[model samples]
Target: MTTTVIAGKYVLGMREGRQALLQDHYVYVDGTRIEAVTRDAPAAGQAVIRYEQGLVMPGFVNLHAHCLRGGLFRGIPDDLEMDPWVPKLVYHILLPLTGIAAKELTPGELHAVTALGMIDLLRGGTTTLVDMWHHGQEMFFDVAKEVGLRTVGAPFIMSASNSRLGEDGNPVWDYGNDGLAQLAKSVALFKARDEGHAGLAQVAIGPHATDTCLPELLRECRRAADDLGCLLTTHFAQTPQELALLRSRYGMSASEYARDTGLLGRNVILAHAGCSTDEDLKVLADTGTHVANCAFGFAREGQNFPYARFARAGVSTGIGTDSHGMDLIGELRVTGLLSKQFFHQAHTGTAHELMRAAT
Candidate 1:
């Protein structure tokens, strides 16, 4: 087998544990692994693809996302008005609508939507992403394989996956929201699809959100992730309602609940953290829990996801596109500008650090 050499004008290579932009570099690829990144030419017979104006770099990793939903609501909710009862855009609009789509759309319709979403990810240069959706994750798996994007399918295990709007315009959740049961289904999906796949797809333990899941269920999710040796991810500190709920029920913040349940760790990737307090940031920093910051979606809902705060707090931070606008480049560019503006610091969310977080 001959090696495929990507010789480019500029390559964003690595040096001394930091990003180094190397000019006139040749990156040798032996199958999937990058064999070398150097200025010297490869010895003898090899396939060479030279690009005089190309800038080669590692593909972006969207740390938290809902690809299908992003496709579904792409152009619809840009200027949506928020109802009084439905204060949270994601809970009231995104997830509920996506769930409805899952039940209403035919399998073929679902396939097309999922494929479009995955294709969008590829077009955006996202070679890998963590897709978190509630139902019909098998459609997600199939689309990931077909499109060839490395996916970590995190089936959302909500303690109350089912809910309905009451007459008073409040969510009336059924009591059948079993977190352990939902988790088992996710694990089964892991064993079935992600077990022997050729590294293109894997699974993660996702317990929806702290407010949506009970304490016992969150604890079980940690154990399940540990037992399976997979990553654990969930929504954290996204809304004021969520924070209030956690504080009311457990008398602890979302970060503290996560820490108490043993879910706060290096293997954990918590999405959002928009409403996190200083103590919560401290918990995130001390536990080494990674934060998947998706500021684009938050901006659409008239909220700023202070990524600079998380970065300054020494929390491990990564980027995600979240529900709509799956363009990760736009995610970084827009989020960086928003961060600098919101935090009143030009140095906040620098291009170098933002690119690093995305990767």
Candidate 2:
């Protein structure tokens, strides 16, 4: 195999159980794999590309995102809390638009929008993105392949509720066949793309949210994920309205319902546990469920996630943009600052800890 040496002024990586910044380091790449990274010069006959002034580090892994509709719904729903926001902006406005756009947009248009999001992700140094969206899984896989980024696409599956505003301006529930066909289609899509994509792409089951899916559906999704040996992700306790809905409907907290329904596990990655309680956090910790903390999106609505609490509770936490922005560096900075401010202790969220979450 052909080998190449990339020499940079500074290399930022791990060494001896700590973060290290090495000066004048050379990284050796043999075809697709990294052979070595060291301060010594490459062999005499090896091809070398030198960067006089740059920092090289591992790429960011965005644990939660929605690429297809991320750029499309910007600026329309601003400065609103979850109560009015969900009914008016999300259910009434964005949901219908998403369905229409998914069907009506031509292939080129779909590719263009998806490519724009992926480019923004790459420009912000994100090498891997886990995205959940409605419709167009194949198109998203195609875009990820074209952009040469590792991606996990989870096609959205909704059962009891479709997130539509009723005549009374409240969120409505459909409660039909529990979206079993959609789940099956998603599993089939996972096998089709994940098995054929040469490891560049993967698939996960997305059940939308706790308030949207039925109990039976959630249980079946967990079983399917275990059977397929893939990840299962959902939005958990994202908003106060969601918490209220869960309490009223199921007489249980979001995390309680999830745990009882067999949804909490190591393979499950939950997004936006901002409204989760201490009990919910305990459930997450005990079950080894991973939390994807996206600070910017929730902060816009005048809220903050319990990231520091999650860290302290021994819950595996990672940073994400949540489709609000693609800049992982900015998200990392915001996560550190917001977490510190929320806890009123600067040492609670150190730069190193935040960097660890991002990576």
Candidate 3:
């Protein structure tokens, strides 16, 4: 029963890498679905918004975003380049709130933070985001539903109680029992209650990071995701120090380790694959895996991803802002520039290549 028109000089689709340029155009939206995109109005819509400048395109999608930690832990630098230690440092230094602390909130603060994070993303033209945060996931879901943004709520789950594995390859939680049983139930409840409620919410599972999830836990999570027919995301090969730890513990790369535990495939998305090797890249390409390149954030930490290597390997690379909030456009531009410099080849990662990746 509702209709509108959005006219801009150019319209682009980041996913499809296509742009429709028009001196004068109109887009008619029937309820939520875009009904028609034409140079002239159909004379049926209720509202017509004419944008003089700025590209009108489908909003960007941030594949890996952390809403709760983004706002609560912003501007706190805990020396992230140290690999395995960085995670421990971040968790200990920024011990925000969880378990007992979560119960203390009256639901208002949770809603506020959720709205605040989504508002920032929406303003940046991010229509959809996959968020992994340990606290206030329910409130986050509610806010996304209300705001009409597509959101995937992934609660941080782990099987290692002590946050690190022991020398015997045994996880510290439940003696390898279901350490994330509560988290699993929470995910199921949220899915059952809100999966299709507002056309804005989907349930996903994030295994935190490799250093935090043991082999058994990762396998179990993968099986669970497969059975439920959902998406699975994880942090893999984030730093050299982390890679060293994995090598010491299992004598294998983190990518191989994840694959061994059944965590690599089309449905699985990895973030910050800075430490991946050539063999790891082959596995990723063969598995049809998707990667979110946080090149700019890593650039700040003095770590540059192997963008040329990844592109050569035929891996589908998507751009992500992480928690930097600089917008995808800037990230995309920086990625292209960095790749060109890293490879020392002018034609390696051109602007059009980066634009195609972003789109």
TM-score of 2: 0.92
| Per-model root-mean-square deviation over C-alphas | 2.2, 2.4, 4.0
Candidates sorted by TM-score, best first: 1, 2, 3
- The TM-score of candidate 1 is 0.93
Off-target runs (Cα >4 Å) in candidate 1 are 83-86, 164-172, 195-198
lDDT of 1 by residue, 1-359 (tens): 56789988999989898999999999988887899999998778766898889888999999999888877888777888884325446656666788889889898988898888888889888999898987455878877888888999899887777754456443445678766778889888888877433588888999877766777888899999999888999988887766776787779877778888877999899999888898899989998999999998878778888678799899999999888877898899988998899888899899999988888
Better model by lDDT: candidate 1 vs candidate 2: 1
Model 3 ranges off by over 4 Å: 1-3, 13-22, 30-36, 44-46, 78-106, 161-178, 194-198, 306-308, 345-352
175-293 in candidate 3: lDDT tens per residue?
54444674576467555754643467877777877767777778878877787777788788886666877788788887778778877899888887778888888888899998878
- Candidates ranked by lDDT: 1, 2, 3
Lowest-lDDT window of 10 residues in candidate 2? 81-90
Model 2 clash pairs are none
Clashes of 2: 0
Candidate 3: 10-residue stretch with minimal lDDT: 92-101
Query: Candidate 1: which pairs clash?
Result: 159-177
